[model samples]
Target chain A: MTETAVTRPTEIEWHGVSPKYIAVDLIGTAVSALIFTAAATVPYWLIQEPWALIPSAAVLLVHLVVLVLTPRRIRSIRYALRADDLLVRRGIMFTRLVAVPYGRMQLVDVNRGPIARAFGLSELKFVTAAASSNILLPGLPAEEADDLRDRLVALAESRRTGL
Target chain B: MTEPLPPRSDTQRPEEREGLGSPLTEGRGADLAGPLPAGNPRTEGAGFEAQQPQPLQSLATAPLTTSLADGEWHRLHPATPLLRGGIALIAIVGFLITNLRDRFIEGFLPMYRDEDYSGDPVEFLVGEGLLFWALLATLGVVLVVVFFFWLSWRFHTFRITAEIVEVRQGVLMRTNRRARLDRIQGVHIQRPFFARLFGAAKLEIEQAGDDANVQLSYLRGHEADALRRDVLALASGAQRAAAAAAPAAPNGVPGLVEARVQELLAPELDPAEAAAESVVRITPGRLIGSVLLSSGTLSVLAVLAGLGIVSLVTGEPIAVFGALPALLGLGTYLVNRITSGLRYSVAGTRDGLRVGYGLLSTTNDTLPPGRVHSVQLSQGLLWRPFGWWAIRVNRASRSSTNAQQQQTRSLVLPVGTLDDAVRVLELMLPGFDAATVQRAAAAKGGEPDDPFTNSPRRARVLRWFSRRRNGFALLPDVVALRRGWLWRELVLVPLPRVQSVAIRRGPLLRALRLAGVHVHTVAGPISSAIGALDDADAQRFFDEVATGAVRAAGNDSSHRWRSAEAAS
Candidate 1:
C-alpha cells in the first residue's frame, strides 16, 4: 500500500561523503590562490601599481577563508539513495536538494580526477533528461562510488522494467 | 535501500547487472548475447525469429524485444545520412581546415624570423602555388566526411513489429532503441525545405520516456507517410486493447471520453485531418505587438538610452558607439521573432494538438494527449494593455541541441487572446476545460477567492518588485501561479507534472511570517512557482499539491500497481 516514488527528505537518510573531501578542497583552493597570487605579482612589478597589492592581499584572505570553511563545506555535502530515487544535498550557504528518481536517470557517470584519485575518492554524476536536473555527488570513497553506480543502474533497470 | 520488487535473478553479479542493465546497450546485449533461455522465456526451444506468441507485449513487461528471427537489416533511405546529420559533419571538417591553416601560419611565425625559416608561410604557400595542395587537403576532408555519411546511412536501420517500433544506428557506440507501441504519444513526419526538394521526410515517433522515442529521417516522402500511418494504426490497436482492459467508468460519458482520448491519440495523418479545426491564429498585429511588448526589447532600449546618457555626460560623441553590438543584437532578435512568428498557427487534430509555425525553417509539431508537462500563459508588460497571452508548454522532449530551439519549440501559441490560451491549455489538459482555464486566468489577483489565494501584505515587501502581481489559483488538477508585475508571468503547473514541492522559508521570509512555495518540474525554460505567500497558506498549498500528485500518480504507476501479484 505504501509503495511509489514519494520523495520525502525525512524518510531518506543521507550519509556524509568521505572526510578527505576537505583536503581536496583545500588543495584546490591553495593551488588556485597560489597561481592568482603569482600572476598578480607580474602587474605589481611591471607598473608598481598600488592596485596590484589588493589582489595578492585578497588571495591571502581567500586562502584563509577557504582553509577555515573547507571542513564545514565538506560536512554539508551529503547524498542518499532511496528505493526509487537518488538524493543529493549540497552547498553550505545556498542549500540545494536535487532528488533524481531512478526511472528518470539517463546516465550515471563516475569521474575520477587526479586530486580525487590521490584521495581515493570519486564524484558520481547523475544525469536526468532535464538539462538542469543533473546531480553531482563529489568525494565519495572510490569503492562506495562504484557500488552506488552499479546499484543505481540496477535499480533504474528494475524500475523501468514492465513500463 | 529496500527494493520494492524482490530479486528476479538471485545469482546475478554486479558486473552482470552492469552489462545487462545499461539502458543504452541493454537491447543489443539481449540479442547479441545469443538469446539466453532465461531472459527469452518465449523462445524456449522455439525458433528465435518468431515474434507472435501473444500480441500484447506492453513494452511494460518485456522491454528488450529481440531482433527478428530472420536477422534481416532494414537500412534507411540512402540519402538519410547525408540529409539529416551530414551538415554537422561537414561543419566540423570545415572548422578543422580553417583552424589548421591558422595554426600552421602561427607556428611558422615564431620560426620565420629565425634561421630555420626564410619567409612568411602564408606567402610562401600561395606564391609557390601550394594552393592546389590545400585544395587537395580540402577534398580529402570532404571524402572523409562522405565516407562517414556513407557509414552512418549504412548502419541506420529501423524495424516495425506489432509490439514495438525500433531504429538502430550508431557508427561506434551502436544503439538499438525500441519504442513500445502502447506508449506512443504522437508521430510526426517532417520535411524541411531542402528535404522536401529531395522528396524525403523524417518520421518522429515520440514515445513516453525521453530515451525511448525513435526519429527516422531521410525516407522517401511517400514511404515516410505510409510508415507514419502504419505506426499510428499499430499504436491505436494497442491502445484499443488497453481501453478494453480498463474498468468501466462510473459514468457512461467518462467511458466515451476515454475511448475518444485514444482516438485523438492516434489520428490518421490524412489530408483531410490536415485541414481539421483551425483553433487559433497569430494575426500580424498581435505578432508585432508581442514582439514590441517583449521585455527583451524594452531592456535593449533601456541600455541604449543609458549609453546615450553616458555619451552626453562624457561629451565624447563616439562613446555612443559602445551601443552598436546591443543595437545589432536587438535588431537580429527582432528579425528572428518576426520570421518565426510570421505564420504561427495551432490546429486541433483528431488525436491531440498540432502547432505549426516558422518562416525560414518551419516546424510542424504534434503533441498527443498527456505529453505536455506544464503550460505557462504569460503576458509581458506591454501585452497587459492589449490582453495578449503567450502560451508555452514544457513539451515532451528529452534534449535539445540548443536552449534557443527549446524555447521556440515549446511555444504552442506564441501570442493570443485570453480565450486562445484557454483553448490551447484545455487541449493539452483535457480534464481542465476552456471554462475552467478562462475563469482561472481572469480571476482576481488579491484575496482568497474560490479559485485564488493571494499573498498577504507582509509577503508583498518580500515579493519586492512583483508585489502587485502575486497570487495563485487551485484547480482540481492544476495550480495556477501569478507573479511578476513588470514582466507578468502566469505559470500553470499540472499536478501530475509536479516532480517535487517544498515550502521554503529563508531567514528574511521566516522573520516576516512569510514562506515561499517552490514547485520543481522537469527542467525547462519556465521555472513555475509563486514566492512570498503567507506561511500558513504556503503549508496548505504544499499539502494540496501533494494530495493532487499522489491521487494522479496512481493513474500512471507504470501499471505496476495494477499488475502486482496481489492485484486482481
Candidate 2:
C-alpha cells in the first residue's frame, strides 16, 4: 500500500518576538565581560600595571566583535509546516535546516518571561523523547504561537492515529 | 418473621424435647401416653405443621451448616519495624549530639591554651557540675524519644494490596504515596557491611518519572527476599499474560537473538579461505612490548620514579622503600598484559560473534547483531603502517554499568584489515556499505578525490609551541556526523543522541573568522569536541547537525514508545 502525505499550512503568521530577548542576552554577555575585566585587574594590582589593561582591552575587543557578529550571522529565522514535518531554518554564515517530524512530537511548552511580556513576545519550546530533540523557538507573537501550537498538536495527533 | 412453637403436650415445651420423639410419650404405658391419645388439636396447628416440615427437611438433606458471615480481611505486611529502626537510629544520633555538647566542644576546639582558660577553677574542679548537666540532657532525650514514639505510632502506615503498594507518612504534614504494580521498573536490594552483619537489607523501589525512590529500610533478610520474589513473580506473570493476549512478538524480547544471529553470521568466508587467514597471536615479547609502550602506564611509572628521586634527595626513609613495591607492581602489570595478549582470540559462531580475552579475569562476550548499536574501526599512526585496525561494537545494556562497560574493551580486536572491518560493519549494521567506510577514512586524511571530504579550515594552524588544527569535517556525506579531538576520539554516535552543541569563538578565532564546536553525547558528563574551524563553516555544520538531530530524535521517540507498548 502506498503511504499518503498529510498536508499542512506552509507559513504561519506569528507576532514578532520580544526585542527584550536580544537585549537581555546582549546585556548578560556584557555584564559577564565586565566582571571578567574587573577580575583580571587583580593581576595588574599585584604586579603588572599598564599591561593588565592591555589584556582587559583585548577581552573587551573580543566581546565587541562577538556582539557585532552574532546578529549579522543570524539570518532570517522562519518555521514552516510541511505535510509530514516541521522545518526551521536559521543562521547566515552556517545555515541550519532542522526538521522535526509531527509524529515524534512529545510536548510543546510556551513560556513568556518578564522581558518577553514587555515586548509582547513569547517562546516556544518543543521536547521529544531524546534529550537532544529539545528546541527553543524564541521571539514569537503570543497569538501566532498559540495558533502554531494548536496546529502542531492537531497534526501530531492525526499522525499518531496513522492518518 | 415470626417465632414458631413445636406441637407438644401442655406439660412439655419445645426446649425440653431432646430426642427424635418425646421421651414422656415414646414406648410408654396408657397413663404416660394419655396426652398423645386420639385427635390432639395441637398437633394439627399451623405453627406445629410449619416447624415439623422445616426441621425434618433440613435434617434429611444435611446437618444445617452455618459459617460466620463476617470473616477477617487480608491485612498487609506492617511498616512498623522499618519505621521504628529508622527513627531509633536518628534518635540515637540526635541524643549523642545534644547530650555530649560539652565533651564535643572540648574535643573540637584546638588545644586549649592556659591563657584562654578564664573560667572559675572551683566550678571546673567540681565533677558534680558535669554530672548535673549530663542528667539534665538525659531527661531531655527521654522526652524526645517519648514524642517520637507517639509520632511513629500515629504517622507510619504501609500496605501492600493485591494491585499496588503504598506508604503513608508524616505526623503533622501527612503525605501518602502509592506505586502501581505495573510501573515498578526494578527492585534494588542493598546491604551495607553493618546491615549485612545485622541480617537486614535496604530495599529501593525504582520507578519511572519519579525523582525520589520508595525505600523500605532494614527489612529482615528472609522477608526482603520473599517480598522481592513476590513482586518479580507478579510482574513477570502480568507480562506473560499480556504477551499471550497479543498476537505480535513483543518488542525488546530476549529472543531477538535469532534474527540478529542470522544477520551477523550471514557473511561467511569459505572454509578453506578462512583457515588460510592468518591469526595474529600475541607472543610474550609482543605483550611486554605493548605494555611498556603504553603511554598511560609508562607515565604513571615515571611519576612514581620522580617522586622517589625527590624523596631520596630529601633523605626520607619511607619514600626510598616505597619505590621497590611500585616497581614490583609495574612488573606484575606487564606480566598480566603478556598473559592476556596470549589468550586474546576472536572468532565467528553460528549464533553470533564471540571475543575472548584476559589473563586472570578472562571474559567472553557474545555480540548478537541486533544488540550492536554501532560498529567502529580505527587505526592510529603506528597501526596505520601495519595495515591493522581495532574494531569496537556499541551495545545497549553494555553501557549502563561499569562491569559491562569495561568488558566492552575486551570485544575490541587488535589486528584487522579494512576488508575485515567492512565485513564486521555489514554484519552489525545490515545496510552499511563498504564505500561509506572508504569515504569516511579518506575524508579523515583530507584526500582530494573523496566527494564528501572537507579541508581543515582552521582559524589558526600554529606549528611552533602549540600545533592546533581546528575546523575539520569527516564523513560530510553521512546524515549523522561524528568528529572528535585528536586526543579523545568518539565513534558512531548519532546526532540525535547529542544533548548539546556549543560553538565558541576565541580571540584569535574571532580575528581569523574561526570558531570551535563541542558536541555533548548522553553517555555521561564528558563531552567530545570537534575543535578549530572557521566561524562560518562551524556554524553551518552546527546547524546541519542540529537539524539532523531533531529529525532523528523524533523518529527515535515514536519508535521507543511503540516498542515499550509492544513489550508491555
Candidate 3:
C-alpha cells in the first residue's frame, strides 16, 4: 500500500498517539469483551445450554485477535494540524484518513478515562457542524491535550464560518 | 428624519459604494459588491455596519413595507387551532366519551358510578335517560378543548425584523426560536389536506441546525406565499423598496365558506409568484411508469411473488400472513409516493429554485441559491430503459424524527427524463456549465476522454462489474462521485459545502491495493462516497479535495447569494 506513498506530500508532519495507549486500550477491550461473553453465556448458566458457550468462545477469539493487534492499531493513529484543517489517520486493515476544516469546528473536548488517566494520557475530540466527521484523536499527554484544545479553539473562533 | 444618518465618508468612489450597499440598489455591481468576501474578517463587521442604517433609511424614504414586515408580532390565522390537530383531538375525545360514558361519568363523578354490569356505556346512558346529560357533558368538553386551543394559539406568536425571524411558542414551557436572516437556508410553505380546506398553509423558516426550524403553522394561504417572498427578499440582503410596492396583500382573511370556495376556484399555480409552467413537467404517464419501475415497487412485487411461491410449494398460507404487515407498509409508501408525485412542479424563480408537489396537501419548497449542499442523481435498473432519473439533495435542515419524510422532502425531482434531470441539476449547482453536468450525468465510464480519474484495472477484483464505472471527478466547483454499473448513481458535492474529505481502505481493499474516497457533506439522503479507486488516485483525491474545500470555503460568499451575484 505504501508503494504509491509519494502521492502524500513529504512536508506535512504527522503526529502519532502515545505508545502506552496500546496497554490501556487492550485492557479496556479485554474487560468489555469478557463482560459481553459472560452476559451471552447467562443462558447457559440458567439452562445449561452447551451451544451458548460456542458463541461465547467465538466472541473471545475475536477479542484475542483485537488484543494482539492493539499495539499496531494504536501506533497507526496519527494526526496533523495543517494550515486550515486537521488531518487524522488510523487503522491498518481498514485505513481511514479524514481532513476536517478548522472553520467548521463546533466544539473541541478533552476527556480522560480512568485507565488512560492512570497512564497520564487524554483524548482530544473535534466536533464539526457535520456529524459524520467524527474525529477523535486519543492518547496524548495531558498537557499536550490541553494546549492542543486551546490552540484549536482559538483557531476555530478566528475562522468561525457558518454552516 | 430626526435620526442623523452615518456620514458617507467612503462614497467618493461609486464602485466602493456599490460594493458596500444592498444588492437591490447595486444590482449590476454584484462581483465586487457581495456583502462579505470570504476570509475578510473585517468585511463581516463592515456588513453589519452597512446593514444597520438601510432599514431606518427605507423607513424614512418609503415606509411602505408590508404590514407583516413592520417589525411587530403577528397572530397566526384565526383557525390555526382547528388546523393544528384540534379537530382530531376533539373527535377522538367525543368518540371515547360516547363509547365509555359509564366509565367517564364514574371517573369524574363517583355518585354516578355504575359497577353492577357494563354492557354498553352509550346504551346504559340512553336507558337511564342520561343521553341529554351526556350530550351536554360532551359539549362542555368541546368548549374546554376549544379554550385550550385558543390559549395555545394566543401564546404562539411570531415576529419578523430585518435581521431575524423570531417564533415564541408554548402555553407554559415557552420556547423561543430565532433564525437569523443571514443563515436562512430555505423557506417552505406546506398546506396539509385539512389546512387546505381552510385555505391555510404552514410556513417553515429553515435554518442550518438541529431542530432550529421556525414554523408558523396555519397562516392564510395567500399570506404564507407573500411572507415567503418577503422573507426570502430580506434574507437575500435585497432592498425591500421594490417588494414594498408589490401588490400582494389581499383585503382580509375571508370566512371559512368563502375561503374554501376561493381555494377551489383559484388556479393551482400562483401565477404571480410560481411560474405558470415548470422548467420540467412530469407527465402522468411518465409519473406512473416511474412509480411502477421504482426499486421499491419492484421489491414489493418480488416479496409478493416470493410469498405466493412459498405458499404454493409448501401448502402453508400462513407464511403469506407473516409478510402481510410488511406488504401493507410498502403499499402505503408506494401510494404516498404516487400521490405526492401528482401535480409535481420544479421551476426556477427569481429568488431561487421553487419545487411544489401534492394533490390534496401541497408543499412549495424554495431553496435559495447555494443552499444545496450536494446532489445525487440516480437511475434504478428499471429506470435505465426509459432514461428516467431521480435527484435528491443534501440540505442543512434535518428533522429529528420521520427521517424518511425528511428525505422525501429533500427529493427535488422524484422522477424525470435525462434532459429534465440535467435541467434540475443545472438549477441546483448554478455556476456549473451544461457540459460538466452532462458529462457527470451521462458518463458510463471506460471512455478514455472522460474527465473523471477512474479506478485502476486491478481494482476490478473488488468492484467486479462496476470496475470501470466507479470513479470520481474533481471539478473546480464540485466533486463528482460516479458508481454502480446497473443502478448508476452520480453524486455532485459543491466544494464549498464539503465539511470534510476522507480516504479509507478496508482489509479487502488493502489486499488489492485499492482505496475509497468520501466527500463529506451534511447528513442527508445523498451519499457522497466513491469506493475502490487506485490507491494513488485516492490519495491524490484526498489531498486535492482537502485543499479545494479549504480554498472554496475561504472564498464562499454563497450564504448571501443575491449579494454575491450582484458583486460578480
Candidate 4:
C-alpha cells in the first residue's frame, strides 16, 4: 500500500532579534581605535610634526565615521524564515536580499561572546555546504536564538525523515 | 500427501528470498553447503526435522574459531618531511636576519669613519666587541639548525585507515585530525621540480571540513598516483553505496560522484581529429612577432640590457650572460609561442566543443556542458583591429588551488574571434544562448551594464608638478581597454580580485563631488588602482557589490547536490 503524504504545520518562523547589537559594534570599534592609537603613538612621537598628524587625524576621523555609521546600519537589519528558505534583508540606502534554502544548510553554530553574554544576546551562524560562505544572524536574544536553532534542526530532521 | 504446513508467507521468510536476490548466492551458498554434508546423521535419523531450527541456529551451533585477521589498515603518507623543510626554511631565514643584524653592528660600524668613536659609546662598543659577537652569532645559527632537525624527527605522524585518514602533528600544541574516507572530494598529486627529482609527490586531499584541505608530505611518484586512485575509488564507492541504499536522491547530489565524473570528462571531439579543423593558422613570422611584442618578452630584454650595462661598467665577465637564466626566459617564451601556435585548433563534436593549445608543456583542458561556473570574454584596444577576444571559464573544483593549476594547463586560445568565444561558451554553459552573448558583446558603448563602468561618481584629479606644472597625476589610473574589431570593447580596472573596498575622498575630489574607491582582491605583482568616481555613485556601486557579495555568501551551495533530495 502506498503511503499518503502527511500535512505538517509550518515549522519555520522568524523571531525578533536582540537590541544589544550597537554595544557589540561600539566595542569592536573602540578596540580597533585603541590598537590604531597605540600603533600611531610611536610615529607621532618620532615625527612630532603637524604634517605627520594630518594622516593620523584623517584615519581617526574615518574610523569614527565608520563606528557611527555601523549602528545606524544595524538598525535597519531584519531576517525572516519561510518553510523552505531563510531570508535576511539589511542596508538603508541600498537594500540587500539574501535567501538561503534549508536543504543546503550544513550546520547551525550558536556563539556567545563576552559582550554578547553581558548583554544577554547570542549570535546564530548558519553554515551552508559551501566552504566559503556563512550567514550570521547577530544580536539575537540568548533563549530565543537557542529555540530558533532547535526548531531549525528539528525541521531539518523531519525533512530528512520524508515527513 | 501429508497436510503441507501452510506455506510460509513471503514477509515472514526473508532467508528464502536472500539467496534469490543476491548474485553471490551461487558461489557463497556452495561454500556454506559444502562444509555440511547433505546427509547428516541427525537429519537422516529424524527422517523429517521435527521442526525447522530457529533462524538463529547458525549462530548458536557454529563453532567459534578465533584467529586474528592478517591485514592491517593502510596509513596515509607522512607530511613530516614537508613540514620540517618549511620549518627549517623559516629558521634559516631567522638565523640570517639575526646574523645580518650582528654583522651590521660588528663588521660595518668599525669601518664607518663618519661616526666619532669618542663621543658615541655605542660606536666604541661596536668597534671593540666585534669579534666576541661574531663567534657567539655563529654558534647560535648552528644551534637553531640542529634544533629544527630534532623537532622534525620528534613530532611527525600520519596514518590512513580503512575508514579515515589521520594526522597527528605539532610539538608544543599537538593536534590530531581525522577525515572520513567518505568526505574526501579529490586527491591532488603535485610534484615540483625538486620533488620530481627526488621521486616524491605531495598529496593533497580536499575534504569538507574546517581545515578545507589535508596534505600528505611526500610519497613515491607512482605510489602517490596509486594512493590517489585508491582513495578516489573508495570515496566514490562509499558514495555510490549510500545512494544505492537510498535511490530517491536528486541527480546532482553527493551520491552522484560517478555521474559527475562522467559528465565532466565526457569526450566530445577527439583532439587528433580536431587538429585538422583549425581555420586560422599561425605563421613563423607571426609567432616571432607575437613573442617580440609581448610585454613579458619586452621586460626580459630591458632587464638584460640593464644588466649588460652594469657588467660593462663593473668590468665583470660578460660571458655570464650566456648562462641558464637568460636562455631559459627567452627559450621558454619562444617554445611556448610555437606550441601555442601548433595547438591552435577548435572543433565541435556531439559531446561538446574542444579547444586545445600549448607548446613545450602541451595541455588539454576539457569542459563539458552544464559544468561551467561562469564565462568571460575579454578584448583590448590593440586586439580591436584584429577582431579577437579571449575567453575564460571558471569551473568548480574540490581543491581551489588544484583547479587553478588545471586552468593554467593551457592558454586555451591566445586569440579567437568574438564568435569563437561565444561558440565555446555555448557548449560550456548550455543555457547560455549565443544570441544573448553576442548581444551583450555588441552593447558595449553608452551606459554599459558592466559593474566597472566609468560613472559621473568617479573623481577626475590631475596632479600638477609642484602645484604649477600642467601634467596628469603621476599616479596614473591604468585602465586597460580592449575593443575587438568585430565585437565589443572590454575595460579592465586592473584592481586585482578585490579582497576589500575602501572609499576615500581628498579635499579636491570632495570639492569636485567625486571620490576615490579602492577595490582590493588579492594583490599580485601589479599595484591595485583607486578608481575615481562620483562620491554617491561610487558609494552606491560599492554598496551594491557588497550586498551582492553578502547574498552570494548566504547561498553557498558549492558542495550542494541535487541528488540529496533523491537519497533522502
Q: In model 3, where do residues sit more than 4 Å from their true spots?
A: A1-9, A33-57, B1-64, B86-136, B242-247, B250-259, B265-269, B319-331, B565-568
User: In candidate 4, what are the lDDT values of residues B1-568, reduced to their tens digit?
Assistant: 1111111110121222233112111111211112322323233113222222222223312221111000122232344354437557678789978856654675667665454346454455567877568668878987886676566444544544333454444555455454544344345455543444444556666443223456666664445544554444333322334322321212344344554343234232233323335434445664455455555676777777877777778888663564348768788876656655554555543223445444322233333222233334655444566656665533223333454354442234455667766665555444433564465454533334432344342222432211111111111111222233333333222111112233444455545655444333221212223334545555554444333433332332212222233236
CA lDDT of each prediction against the hidden true structure: 0.62, 0.45, 0.75, 0.45
Q: Regarding DockQ, does 2 or 3 come out ahead?
A: 3
A best-first ranking of the candidates according to their DockQ comes to: 3, 4, 1, 2
lDDT tens readout by residue for model 4, A1-163 = 1101000112325444655878887887888887786676666689787676765677677789878888776775667766545555454444333454443344577899888788888898765433223367888888888888877765544322100
Model 2, span B1-568: residue lDDT tens: 1111111112222222224222212211211212434533233332312212122122222211111001111122243443446557778889978975655566678465234433644236444467567667878997887777656544544444323444445554455454533334345444443444344555555432213345565564334544554443333322323322322212343344454343233222223212222233445554455456555466768878887888979988777677777778777866755655545555443223445455433333434323333344555544454444556643322122355334434245544556655555544444444575655542443445443323244422631211222233434222323343232122444443443344554455445555556553322222344444545566666656555554554443211222233355
User: How well is each residue in B1-568 modelled by candidate 1, as lDDT tens digits?
Assistant: 1111111121111123233222222322221122222533222214323222332333433221222211234667787766777578679869978866655675678655333333756567777899789789979987997898887777666666554665556666555555555346566666666665555667777754433357888776556655554455344433334423322212333454454343233333344445465578788887987898788899999999999999999998775788998999999999888878866667765356777666544456777655567788887768888888888887545433456756776777888889888877777777774575576564445534435677777775667656545877677777888777666677887765565555555556656766566666665567776777876677677667655654554344322111222232
The worst-scoring run of ten residues by lDDT in candidate 1 chain B lies at: B1-10
User: Candidate 2 at A2: error in angstroms?
Assistant: 34
lDDT of 2: 0.45
How much lDDT does candidate 4 score?
0.45
Q: Mind giving the per-residue lDDT tens digits that candidate 3 earns over B1-568?
A: 1111111111112223323343222211211122322323223223222222223223322333676655566889989987778578779879977976777678789887646755676668888999999999989988998898888787777767665666656665656555556567888888888888878889998876555577899798887878888888777766656557666666687787987888755655577776447878988889988988888888888888888899999999897896798788877987888888888888887678889888887888999887898998999988887888999998887677667769777999999987888888877788775576576566678786888788888988878888788898888788888899888998899888888889887878877778888887887787888888887888889989998888887777666666654445
How accurately is candidate 2 docked according to DockQ?
A: 0.07
Q: What pairs collide in candidate 2?
A: A15-A141, A17-A139, A94-B540, B470-B532, B471-B532, B471-B533, B514-B535
